[model samples]
Target: MIEILNPTLLTRAAGTGALVADILHTLKGRSTAGTNLLDIDRWAKAMITEAGALSCYVDYAPSFGRGPFGHYICTAVNDAVLHGRPRDYALADGDLLTLDLAVSKGGVAADAAVSFLVGDGEHPESVAMINATERALAAGIAAAKPGARIGDLSHAIGTVLSEAGYAVNTQFGGHGIGSTMHQDPHVANTGRPGRGYELRPGLLLALEPWVMADTAELVTDADGWTLRSATGCRTAHSEHTIAITADGADILTLPKHMRP
Candidate 1:
């Protein structure tokens, strides 16, 4: 379902977005060499509970996944990209980690993700991949505004990834988010401009740009949730929840310190 949040709900959305961003920021700081993925999930649970919010993932049961997620957050490392279920493995130096989080508070939900290298690893390729996704996400956000079409944002994102020499995967991409986690108006990573749904004020969209180093194909791990690159090449993902307004798109998931 597509939801155009009212002014009151939009205010609540900003709060939820801040919580999501803060949780991710804290998790990224805590994740290092020898840190267990399960620990990250536990941390997420505690923070969410403390904030009096609900996790959109714990009870998330979709056709693609094995069952209810049963996890607080998604921890993707190295080759893994989307729907990464937290496991018992400890991270190593130079490991690329992606933390995706979604939460609801005051009856509104927000979602975001960030990919970064663990420890003081000098992996240039991983850094480049992460930068590319971040740049692509910015491009998508720049294209979002009242009267702008969804394809415009997708095209902007795809242009950045293609230019970075990374293959784009369409199996999973950004989507509308509001009271619930995933909503309608599926936003693909790549599409033609001037096509698809037109943007409007009060519309909330989670724009994510993810890419694999070599191929666009993906292989699901034995856990039946984590999606990894077919070639085992490193990957990166960047995302943010944006609200369309009269002036432009307002990024709701930016951390408190990063907000204007």
Candidate 2:
């Protein structure tokens, strides 16, 4: 379902987006060598509860996943990329970690993700992968404007990834998000430009660009939720939720402290 939020609803969406961003920022700060994945989930749950918001992950049971997600945040480390379910694992130095989060507040939902290195170390490949996703996400956002087609955004994103020498995966990508966590108007990471649904004011989209180091293929872990690279190469993912507006796309998931 494609959802357009009114001014008031857009304000609420901003609030939810900020909340999601803040939580992710906090989680990233807390994640370090020896940090347990479960601890990150606990921190997210507490923050969400304290903000009087609802988690879009817990109790989430989708066909692509096992039963309920049963986690507050997605902690994807190293080889793990999408739908990473928190487990009894501790982070290690130089481990690439991706934190994806979505939450609802005041009846609106916002989703975002960030990938970073856990500890101080020079993992050039991992750093490059993370930077690629971030750049692709920025490119996608730049292509989002009123009257712009979804394909334009996808193409912009794909261009960045492909130029960086990373293979694009279409199995899972961004999507429309509103009152619910996931919605219609699927946004692939790669697509032809000048196609797909045209953008309009008030439309909300979560554009995520993710890639594996060596392969586009993915393998589901035994947990049934964590998706890893087929070649066990490091991966990275970056995402942001933006609201379509007259001027352009307004990034909703940017934390207040980081905003100018």
Candidate 3:
């Protein structure tokens, strides 16, 4: 489904985006060396409850996953990239961690993710990969405007990753998000420009740009959720929920303190 928030509903969506961004910001701050993945999930759950919002992940049971996600946040560490189910593991210094969260408030949903090194990891390759994803995400957002095609966003994102020496994976990418969570207009990380759905005012899209260092192939962990690089190469992901407007694309999922 392609959801276009009406003026009144868009107001509610703005709140949902703020909540998602706030929770992600808080969780990122708390994640560090020796931090348990479960603890991060707990922190997110508490914050969501305190805000009177609902978690889009807690009961997310898509056919691709084992069962209901049962977690408040996705903690993808190092090799792990997508659908990372929280487990009994403590983060160590130099570990690359990705925190993805989605929440609904006032009947609207927002999703976002960030990847960063746990402690001070000065590995050049790792740092480069992280930076590339962030750059790609920015490019995608820049291409998302009224009358823009999904392919334009995809092409913009792909250019960054490809130029940075990383391989793009298309198995899972961004999607339309609204009141119920995932929606239509699948946004791939790489594609031809001037194609796919045309952007329109009031449309909400979650543009995520993720890349694996060496291979585009991925292997699902035994857990049936966590996706890891086939070559165990490092990975990074960056995402944001944006809404189309007459003015341009408004990035709704920016943290309150970081808003423009």
Go through the candidates in order and give each one's C-alpha lDDT: 0.95, 0.95, 0.91
Per-prediction TM-score to the true structure, in the order listed:
0.99, 0.99, 0.98
What is candidate 2's lDDT per residue for 111-222, written digit by digit as tens?
9999999889779988889999999999999999999999999999999999999999999999999989899899999999999999999999999999999999999999
Give candidate 1's error at residue 23 in angstroms: 0.7
Q: Kindly give the stretch of ten consecutive residues in candidate 3 with the minimal lDDT sum.
A: 119-128
Off by over 4 Å in 3: none
RMSD to truth, every model: 0.6, 0.7, 0.9
lDDT score at residue 259, model 3, on the 0-100 scale:
88
Candidate 3, 1-260: lDDT as tens digits: 89888999888988899889988998899998999999999999999999999999989999999889889999999998898999999999999999999999898999999999888867788888989999999999988899999999999999999998887889899899888889989999999999999999999999999998899999999988899999898889999999999867999999999888
| Clash number for each model | 0, 0, 0
**What's the C-alpha lDDT at position 92 in model 1?**
97
TM-score of 3: 0.98
* lDDT of model number 3: 0.91
